[model samples]
Target chain A: MRVGVVTFPGTLDDVDAQRAARVAGHEVVALWHGDHDLQGVDAVILPGGFSYGDYLRAGAISRFAPIMTEVIAGAQAGLPVLGICNGFQILVEAHLLPGGLLRNDHRKFICRDQTLRIENTSTAWTGAFAQGQEIVVPLKNGEGQYVADAETVARLEGDGRVVARYVDVNPNGSVNDIAGISNERGNVVGLMPHPEHAVEALTGAGTDGLGFFTSLAGVLA
Target chain B: MPKPEILDPQGKAVLGALPRLGFTGVTDVRQGKRFEIEVPEVTEAVLAEIAKMADSLLANTVIENYTVRVEQDA
Candidate 1:
């Protein structure tokens, strides 16, 4: 399968995402933020970084880029989209996912290896994992706290849209300790943690994050 | 300081209950606050000051971005 990773002007993780895709046995394509084409890839990833320098709100400006128009259309057609960190912020800004990310309640940027429980593994990106599985990924960001109306939260929980939940401690004070969520159709997933950074054991964070990429292999096969 | 949205549902609900408990003429109420400061000199020094504000508090560099407007009042 071919996977495309979009690189905005300020993106920092596109290369890492590409490498991870290759490790999972897929051909990788580098896509530009200014382009509206998907390059006919089977899946897409919006990698992490301070896109557009996080101007006018994280992911706010990036949400309007030409590529997102295609991304929205592709996601609607059941194409899988995985958004990490700032990419997650962009997904929310674009309304492809619910909830808003806010400044860390601690009023500081946080970076650490975090453990997350796989809550629902039926999504296009997580089908390889069993429910309640624990995986470690790097979590780093200043505005990582997630918030939404109670009704929205309830609905997400009821529909099994929550994909992951933070374990041990709530790093950014997200409501109900939500760490990741999938869209209703289970094709789009967004999470604040940097899974790409944790994909290699030699890098020291452990290779548990590789499941995300490898899981897609099973789906595409 | 940035202008946050004032439609805090929880805060609004609490304020709405006040009028029923004897408060009157409270037509519609909303709550939010702004902060203002003056930089002593309008020079490179002021730009530096604004940059510090952006880094420290005016915006959450990780999630939010901000714009600054400076005006001179005689």
Candidate 2:
């Protein structure tokens, strides 16, 4: 499958995502934020970074980029989209996902090897993991806290749309310990951790994140 | 309720300095924002529009809520 990795100004993770995609045996296509074209890729990945300098709000400005129009439309049409870290913020800001990301509860940027429980593997981005699998990946960000109205939280839980939850400790004080979630259709998954960074054992904390990339093979099949 | 989940460092700072500045017995401080939105001859339609703007953009409904008040332009 051909996976398009979007690059916005100040995007630092597109390369990592592309590398992960290549490692997972998928063709990697580079997509630009300023262009509306998706390059006709089979799926899209919005990688992490300080997109738009994290100004106004994290992911606030980037949500308006020309590429997001195509992403939003494509995602609505069942085109798979995975948003990681800052990209997750963009997904929520774009209303593709519910809830919002606030500053870390401690008001500090945290970087560490974080553990996450795969709560729902039916989503397109998590098809490789068995339900209840625990994986360690890198989590680094200031505005990484996930928040939503109580009713929305209940709905996400009841609908089985919550894709992952923080394990052991909630690093950012995300409500219900949520580290990631999926849209109702299950084609869109948004996670605060950087799975791309953990795809390789040589550089990353572990190969636990390889599933996020490799899972696409089944999703696209 | 001033969302216990939302940090109020700014408000806490003010509350802390109040005692040193000789303002006594003030129990708490809840800090927020104010906006002077100018509309052409404020009408029901305009008020609704402004409210929508706040709900959709100005305030993040997840962490914050806002109130709107309109006054005549001097």
Candidate 3:
């Protein structure tokens, strides 16, 4: 499968995401933010970064990038889209996902190896893991707290749209300790942690994040 | 100024007990840090530069957003 990683001007994690995709046996396609075409890639990743220098708001400007128009259309057609960190913010800003991220309750930039429980494994991006599985991935962000109306939260819970929950500690005071979520159809997933940064065991963060990329192989097969 | 997390365990413990100490109507409270910067003169260019500094370093635009105000010291 060809997986495209979109690189906005200030995107910092596109390379890492591309490397992870290659390691997972997918042809990695580098997509630019201004391009309206997806190059026929089977899946896409909106990698992390301070896109547009987070000028107006984190991911606020990037959500309207020309490439997102194509991404939105592809995602609607059942193409998988995985958004990490800033990319997740773009997804929310675009209304492709529910909820918004706020500053950490503690009000500081936090960086740590965060533990997360895989809450829903049936999504196209998480099918490689068993539900309730515990995995550790690096999380570094200042505004990682997630919030939404109580009704939306309840609905997400009721529909099994929540894909991951913080374990051990709620790193950013996300409502209900949510660490990640998927769209109702499960083709789109967004999380604040840098799963690509945790894909290699030699890197010391463990390779638990590989499941995200490898899960696509199963879906494509 | 950015609000810091209440990290001092003892401080948090004391604040946590304030509501029980008859401090009624205290909905929520968190500790924070305060900082002051002195600018030689305030100008549109200078203020814009400060905003850039805040965006680039003083705040992590990803998680923390900032508000800036200018006041002349008497």
Q: For residues A1-79, could you state the per-residue lDDT of candidate 3 as single tens digits?
A: 9999999989999999999999888999999999999999999999998999986567888887999999998988899
Task: Indicate whether candidate 1 or candidate 2 has the larger lDDT.
Answer: 2
Query: How far off is residue A76 in model 2, in Å?
Result: 1.2
* Candidate 1 per-residue C-alpha lDDT over A1-221 given as tens digits, one digit per residue, 9 for 90 to 100: 89999999899999999998898788999999999899999999999999999876788888889999999999888899999999999888878898878777665699999999999989988887889999989999988888877888999999999999999999988988999998999989999998788778898389878878877877667
Which residue pairs of candidate 2 clash? Answer: none
Which candidate ranks first by TM-score, i.e. highest? 2
Residue B61 error for model 1, in Å?
20
10 residues in a row with least lDDT, candidate 2 chain A: A100-109
User: Which candidate leads in DockQ?
Assistant: 2
lDDT of 2 by residue, A1-221 (tens): 99999999989999999999999999999999999899899899999999989876688889889999999999999999999999999999889999989778776789999999999989999999999999999999888889888899999999999999999999988999999999999999999999899988999998899999899899867
- Docking quality of model 1: it rates as incorrect
Checking candidate 3 for backbone clashes, the offending pairs are A142-B63, A143-B63
Error of 1 at A78 (Å): 0.9
Fnat of candidate 3: 0.00
Angstrom error of the Cα, residue A143, model 3: value is 0.9
In CAPRI terms, where does candidate 3 land? incorrect
> What interface RMSD does candidate 3 have?
9.3
Interface Cα RMSD in Å, per prediction:
9.6, 2.7, 9.3
